[model samples]
Target: MWFERPPGVPDWSEAESYLRRADPALGAVIDRVGPCTLAPRRDYFVVLCKAIFTQQISTAVATTLFGRFRDLFPNRRPTPARVIEVLGRADPAVLRGCGLSRQKTSYLADLAQHLADGRIPTRRLAGMDDEAVIEALVGVRGIGRWTAEMFLIFTLNRPDVFPVGDLGVVDGLRDVFNLPARPTPAEALALGERWRPYRSIATWYLWRRGSVPVAAPAVPVPDAVAGAPPCARRRRPRPAAAPGAAISPARPRAQK
Candidate 1:
């Protein structure tokens, strides 16, 4: 279940109204998707870790690997101490076997050390503004602007964040606006200005629009024993032909 919006959160509708008054294109999209609220997620550490895991990977694969990592330490989410405890003595190959790249493993370990040494407190970031949060997060190795922006949107649930560097957002703009070519990140930032404070919600919708739904796995049938009769396979029925393709009862059938 999703967490409810905290009390006194800014009204998205009002933001939408402001954007609509600013640009017709943004207003049109807002009209279509309607009001959107921030989708709350787990705390900073988990979100950052997951984001690191998901870098340059498909969502399905990332989800599977993240699940496996969680199973390794049941009930407790990955914390700084837990990361150090599990990874300090564990072989690098073992972490790599969990689908983490060597660079990511090193980066995560560095992050854990920073957290453990009181260099950065996860809780202290909450009260800071977006820029400040980004500044602090990117101070750690391997954490970039895109990762920090994700932390802002997913973990902090900040009202305004537009990751102009995101490829999906750029593609979304091209597809939605019917542009001949994809815009550069700079161009995307300029275009995103129209969305303003509700850019986070707009970005969420853009991602949702471009994401392909994952198909469920197919169930396997049991193999037949040595003496057992083979089970019949079931097939889906085809749809009936339309009027033009239908055969008339009055017409004589042609022999094959």
Candidate 2:
């Protein structure tokens, strides 16, 4: 059962109709998965920070690290100014202590700097088209095309993004379409042509195919290193992937 509109998200019935009409292979997935249920998040920097932190880490680990990270902020939430201030006081080692890698630490610092300097104005994103938004976001350190695509889908709720580089998406397509081998990014893009204008809906279904459900990050992470937000709670352990399942690696390539 699909809603005409799901709270903050745009109506998805059009996208649903298009995807089913465009490809029977995807139609099967829709039949199994039902409807798109993406909800937008308001905190641009937090979500981007989470995306960077999540690079190459399991969701469980990422959840833990994010909890530790939000502790550094005054309210368990990070704004550009506060992030910059915290980074200044806490050296690289301190950040790494929160489960961040050297590269990710540098990436966060760079992002904070960009946001503070207004080089990557989060407010301007609403007026820009998808490719322009990607261009803007990718200019930041450690943020790639795949990351940009994710922002478009999860943050802005753009409908047509197809993250061809995502392993989950690739594996989903491979299994769903019965391809002889995992399709290359180019092949994935070609295969996705039919789902145009609503590819994001299709992507939502693909991700669901082999994913473990976790509570949304909207619940702030708990156990602050410095008396951060009290709203954070530890996420429960998730079951491991089944044998021969498609493994989602950290940071999909930003190409094709």
Candidate 3:
């Protein structure tokens, strides 16, 4: 059997150098997070199937459901024939209970049909560019830019993909840049240009930074005010105020 790495994959140092010059904020994050490597998969079908299983669900939950799906077909990785045999007459409710949304169920079924009909041409995807891969995969019901980008990253191991549509990337940018609001997809795409040719590595750092807890900002207490009377300390409010009472009003009443 022949084996090959996917196209557009850059060496780690090359990707890291590009990211380091792209943005200081992201460069710091990359330093902290270190290198990330894509998980290996034997073929496009397994990755696409996992992508279908993962939509709109937590990673843990997706793993559980995928485990069950895999258990249902122990002889081999899920093929269209095997999937149809297990899911064709199965209740939609049962599938939903397995954690698949209604739309995802439809998407999976459609994907299986396409695979069976030879419409997807999975082998051809490896040789295609990012845009071509997206165009091919998006024809399926549930696959969008994010999903296609995931396939490109994990399955094809493409080094330059940036999933600007991902909420994680948006949150990462907000945290790293201290932005007042999360960046929109267009904004992220525009901002990501500097990382070009290695956006995927930059994205991995962003994802890692987003997952780590940020330290709270240190607050400073003011030094004693000049000309303040020693008795001024006695004027402080007591902590025994009623639960509904205002703790600090905008204006204090004049002393009687």
Worst 10 residues of 1 by lDDT: 247-256
Over 114-134, each residue of candidate 1 has an lDDT whose tens digit, in order, gives 777866676687788899888
Question: Cα deviation in Å at residue 219, candidate 2?
Answer: 42
Model 3 residue pairs with clashes: none
How do the candidates rank by lDDT, highest first?
A: 2, 3, 1
Ranking by TM-score: 2, 3, 1
Backbone clashes counted, model 2:
2
- Candidate 2 is scored at a TM of 0.78
For candidate 2, lDDT tens digit of each residue in 61-93? 988988999998777988888887887788777
In model 1, the clashing pairs are none
Whole-model lDDT values for every prediction? 0.62, 0.71, 0.62
Per-residue accuracy of model 3 over 30-140 as CA lDDT, tens digit each: 565555545435567667777777765656787888876676676647887777676777777777766777666777788888777877777677788999888778887
Q: Where is model 3 more than 4 Å wrong at Cα?
A: 1-11, 89-97, 100-103, 211-256
